[model samples]
Target: MTEATHDDRHPMTGNRTDAGVDTGIERHEYDVVVIGAGGAGLRAAIAAHDAGARVAIVCKSLLGKAHTVMAEGGIAAAMGNLYADDNWRVHFRDTMRGGKMLNNWRMAQLHAQEAPERVLELEEWGALFDRTADGLISQRDFGGHRYARLAHVGDRTGLEMIRTLQQRAVDLDIDVFMEFTVTELFRDPSTGSGGTGGRISGAFGYWRETGRFVVFESPTVVLATGGIGKSYQVTSNSWEYTGDGHALAMRAGASLINMEFVQFHPTGMVWPPSVKGLLVTESVRGDGGVLKNAEGERFMFDYIPEFFKKETADTIEEAEGWYTDKKNHRRPPELLPRDEVARAINSEIKAGRGSPHGGVYLDIASRRSPDFIRRRLPSMYHQFKELADVDITQEPMEVGPTCHYVMGGVEVDADTEQSIVEGLYAAGEVAGGMHGSNRLGGNSLSDLLVFGRRAGHNAAYHSMRTKQRPTVSAEQVKAASAAALHPFEVEGGENPYTIQTDLQDVMQRLVGIIRTEAELRDSLAEIERLKERAKRLSVEGHRQYNPGWHLALDLANMLVVSECIAKAALERQESRGGHTRDDYPTPDDGWGALNLVLTLPSDSDSVDLKHQPLPVMPDDLKTLFEES
Candidate 1:
């Protein structure tokens, strides 16, 4: 993967160095470059290929190992296999409500309408979902949905979905470059006839295996690099979720919306210290697990938010009865949206009602039979047993909130998945405005499929229709390569790992699930201090498979994204959904009227915040809520 430093006659490594004299960098061309290998990236590449375009997938890890593989809950789709009355409208209503009415109406509508089709397509691609007695794909209950909408393969739904998509992509012969970290997006700089300011031209990155530079030149680029969970100390997200796409898009002049909202899932393993932030699948609660305090009381009923009072049961009897007779009784308080449940767990711990490990008890052992538990949630059983040395079938597990998902990201066109940058697009969690303030338990999966396909199709069409070919100057490539190698050149400086860990501590302690103006301001100040440290960060050893260098590059992205989150959180004083401000503890309709948008100017390191009015839902879609 080493780039050729000299022009012409440079030894051929069987890779092109982008159309001309090579600076020794490996270069390739494609109609579309999808910068991720997860579900969304794979689906986007597949769609682009089917739409008559050459596509390549660049990922930070080996195929099939993306964070999407760690998703335990099922894909939310209104398949109605378990409940005949369930449909897309109900799913849409639930999603909008779950997001606290902050979701893009069009995106929510399109996701609900298209998710079932995408799920069925995955089945056709050989995904074997758990089936009902009638041989239809089985659907299960999850938080925020009105019915059994999540089509799952037990609790390993993401693995099955990714495996199926991966196989399909491999079968289609989509070009894949694994272990590559894209550091910079190349856009046209000329403001003349055809300037790069509006469109993306290519991407510059390094192969992780060899630590050499690689360039991907494409007419269109799709960013599907997932979330920013790694910015926090405790998170269910993997190492790859380091705000790559978010920061990359921001650098390329894209705006991020609703950056204040970050979802802390209610059921992460909170014991043994080693696996403190490991995700305990929501399927555990969906399958009748109840949240109890140290006092052995079902404490969720005591913490139900006013917004969900009408939908959630007030008593254990009604809550328990609803599982069997949903038509007559409201859902259990434990089955409330992740934000509400996470806040409740936070409150309990603050009030001295938490378990010995600083979390609340999530018990399914006393409710569901052992056989049923093993059959339904094999992964949870094994995860608890192997990771925490606790058998979930025999005992209640200590669980608490862990940073799970970011509801804000690169703002994009809801229908096409294209960002404000003409040739740049985003999908899955990287794209914003789809989930709004807080995402439902299972909608993340469906959001990927629905928007991934749209982004791919539109990107391909744009690529084919464009008359001009965007250029990536030799100077731009050299600059990218130089920036990547700077950490190695420094003789003495702060360790990248120390800076990252310090940044994480700042985020976890000050800008976490519950925040205050003072703490957020402190976090911003800490981020500024860390930014200086990051500039002086250094790493030992060569680039080849160097984890330190990798973290160094990731640190830059995380710093920018952390600033965006803290800044937005500070501006939005009122508490709503995932962004709970201890200082301002209630939702404010006036604040809801506008989304806080973060943008980075080309000339400045500072992030500018602006208020973008929330799009009014059309009367037709608003009618659905009226009916509810």
Candidate 2:
């Protein structure tokens, strides 16, 4: 199929100039521009720079403190002999099982194969992962890993990983633009045809430090802007994960796939309203923590499905048996995959055995010594002590499901990160079909490493091969600049914070872990109202270092992402991994075989939703599956 081109109404075509005009704004040009500075963005910039391309890494936050710092758990890999016979094949099968078979075969294959090297690469770059006596990187069990495959640095794995990448990027002399937000893409002006004109030219954004608009004209733009978990109030993700990449890509005419499949992490802190939804790392359970009810009963064995029944233990005795003989039995009941644990918790809550916080309790007090708990789960101790005044080593932690990751994102070919939009590419959480309906715990970090480098390499290679410098029209920069600055123009009516809060509340209440058509429709209408209110919302201060103004701008992107999610949820007729529809309580085979693709409509208020066929696996896929 041919690519879609920019319409006459597209902002890029309004101005034509062979030599790119700066519009007197802060003009930065590069061979490649990366929109996020997290793990993927840093890695992409490093790769692009190493490939002899001049690159820039732009982020909305301080250097080294991107959303990646908040990632807990660990990076997934398939290093053999962590358990006997454990390899990429087992990791692949486990991931496919966890995702309910909706994963892109090629992406999954690549991830399982390449993740080990990526993790080791981090080690080579000065990441200090906890190691075993044999001198290999120590591995831990996370939900959905058939073996102990997650390589971690205690519980601050993301911090360790991101710091390594950030330091590496700095070491490589990659241009870093901190506190800059890319609001829109610049398209090539020469191609007027629908499919051809959509080539990406550059990007326009605002610099928080200067309080001025900035534009970059680049031959290639890689969007690694991460996931949209902040769309809901109860999320384990950071404030920076506002789905900027997804929204920006959709607006640029790329199709977003599986948007309805948002993964609600099974264990988030459920107390102290301020930090109520912060993530309690899966590493807690991985280190032998147990989930309990108000009556102190272990309950996951009762909820085990037939698929996992053979591998999983049943009673407390059986679970205890595995700790002694790891090879003879599966890990304890608490270490079941996230979806199973979440459903078990939901069932317990419904059965009136929940904790005081309306969730269940996760306790490790009886399982391990205080020193071991303190050393392995330091963040859990610090988080509870600072946020809830509870010592995890001495007390049971209150936990429940909270929106964490989006399994759905821009649909792309597995090997190539190219989206439906020819010039547009996405990787990491911004690109989808790798995790299917639900992602396993540690897979995300590994995914970033594998795909981020691939995207950077491919984008750089493509730009070099084409030798076409796509120009950002002067008019496109001006329009994007005006739109970005419009948030500060509103001086009265609703506050952006209030509108954003309402948007979160609506999404969490109606379109959350479970959904129905009526609830989804209500969410849509409420979102429209929220969007209207957002237009009238105002910021009280100047743009320089103003979080309020930044939020005001982010709200527009959040609203766009929320609308797409709700619309996609409403259209899908069956329950899938992360997207559970009450109206259609079971998964339909027809729906299971396809992915939902959402694109931004010409009228920005509505979304254009479509379905695309999933890849038909060839003989190689069968071999990979069998070996896995």
Candidate 3:
């Protein structure tokens, strides 16, 4: 799979370096270029091909190995397998409420309506989901859902989903360029691919292995490059999530919305420093796990959901002494209630009642039988035993907050998924307005499929309808190539890894789950200072397979995105959904109606923040909220 396009018309090598790209650089042409081959990118490519477009998928990692594989929860869709009364309307209502009503109603509506079809489509493409006694695809309940709506393959649903999508892609012969890092997106290229006067032109990147440049000229581009979690010090995301898509969209002149809304999962592994921040899936709590602080007290009774507090509040007094009883841990059991659990752990840690590793204790050992633990959670059992030397059936696991996903990203048209830049599109975690302020546990997979299909089909149609071809700017390509190589040219300078670590620390501490204006302002100052120092980062080795050079390139993206998060968090002045502002402390009605958008102007290096009115939900849709 070395720099080659797979198709009937192309050679086995498949690579078309002959596109006359500035000698030595490989170049090719396609109708649509889909970057980031995660679930969304793969789905988008499949959709583009079905819409009669020659599609190419460019990914930072090998195909089927995108961060989507790390997803532990099942895909959310109202299939009605387990719950006969479940339907799209109910799912839509749950999604809107879960996102605290900041979600674009149109996107949420479409996602809810189309998710079931997408799940079935995956099945048709050879995905094998766990089935019920009736032999229909099994659905499980997740946080914020009223019924069993998630169709899963145990907890490894994401891995299976990717495998199915990847195999489907193989059967379709969609050209996949694996291990390619796209550093720059070229808009309106002038001297297009290889002097081929009327050639496809848009993207410029490089192979991670050889370090040689590669360009793809396409009329339509879909950015499914995932989230900005890697910018934080503690995260469950992989190394590739350095906000490449977010930064590329900004550079391509697209705006980002809700940049401050980053989701921090409640329980990431906190022991054995080497495996810290690894996600201890919510399933542990779902299948009976208890949260305790250093004082050996089971503390969930203190943090039940506000809605259920009245009924459960009185029981708290009765349940207080029951902490001595092992079987009583699951008594109040409103389910771990993700938001409340995270808040409770943070509170304990802040009060210095945390575990030795600075996290609350999630004990499943005394509550569940060893056999039940192994049967229900094979992954969790091994994840703890192998990674941290902690046996879930024997001991409590240290858990804390770790950045998981971002609800903020490139704002796009609800239906078409196109960005401010006409042909540029985004989906999955890279596209916002769908998840709005906060995302539900299983909604991420559904969002990827629903918007991925829309983005691909629409981008392909946009390509088909265009009368004049857009060329990639040669100057932009040359400049991008130069920037990729500059670190090797520097003599004495800062180390990219050091700068990246510092940036992550700044983001994790200041612009994290809890925020304040002064901390955000200080983060901004530190980011600006890092931005200046990053200009002088030097590489110890040549570009070929050089990790240092990669970080140097990624540093710019992390810096810019960190700036966006910090600036947006600073401006919002209110706590809502995933953006928790310590200073403001509560959601403001005015802020609820307005979305914060950050756009990078070509003339300036800094991003400019502005407020945009959220699209009004139609009367018919608004009535759903008013209804029971």
Candidate with top lDDT is 1
Give the Cα RMSD of candidate 1.
2.7
Whole-model lDDT, model 2: 0.82
Top model number, TM-score:
1
lDDT of 1 by residue, 94-155 (tens): 99999989999999999999999999999999999998899999888888887878899999
| True-structure lDDT of candidate 1 | 0.88
Misplaced by over 4 Å in model 1 are 1-20, 191-196, 312-330
lDDT of each: 0.88, 0.82, 0.83
User: Where's the lowest-lDDT run of ten residues in candidate 1?
Assistant: 3-12
TM-score of each prediction = 0.96, 0.92, 0.92
Candidate 3 has an lDDT of 0.83
Q: Regarding lDDT, does 1 or 2 come out ahead?
A: 1
Residue pairs in clash, model 2: 3-195, 5-194, 5-195, 89-628
> For candidate 3, lDDT tens digit of each residue in 478-551?
89888888888887899998999898899988888889989999999999999999989988766667888888
Question: Order the candidates by TM-score, highest first — what do you get?
Answer: 1, 2, 3
lDDT of 3 at 75: 93
Write out the backbone clash pairs for model 3.
19-194, 20-194, 21-194, 189-471, 189-472, 189-473, 190-472, 200-217, 201-217
Root-mean-square deviation of Cα positions for candidate 2 versus the true structure, in angstroms: 6.0
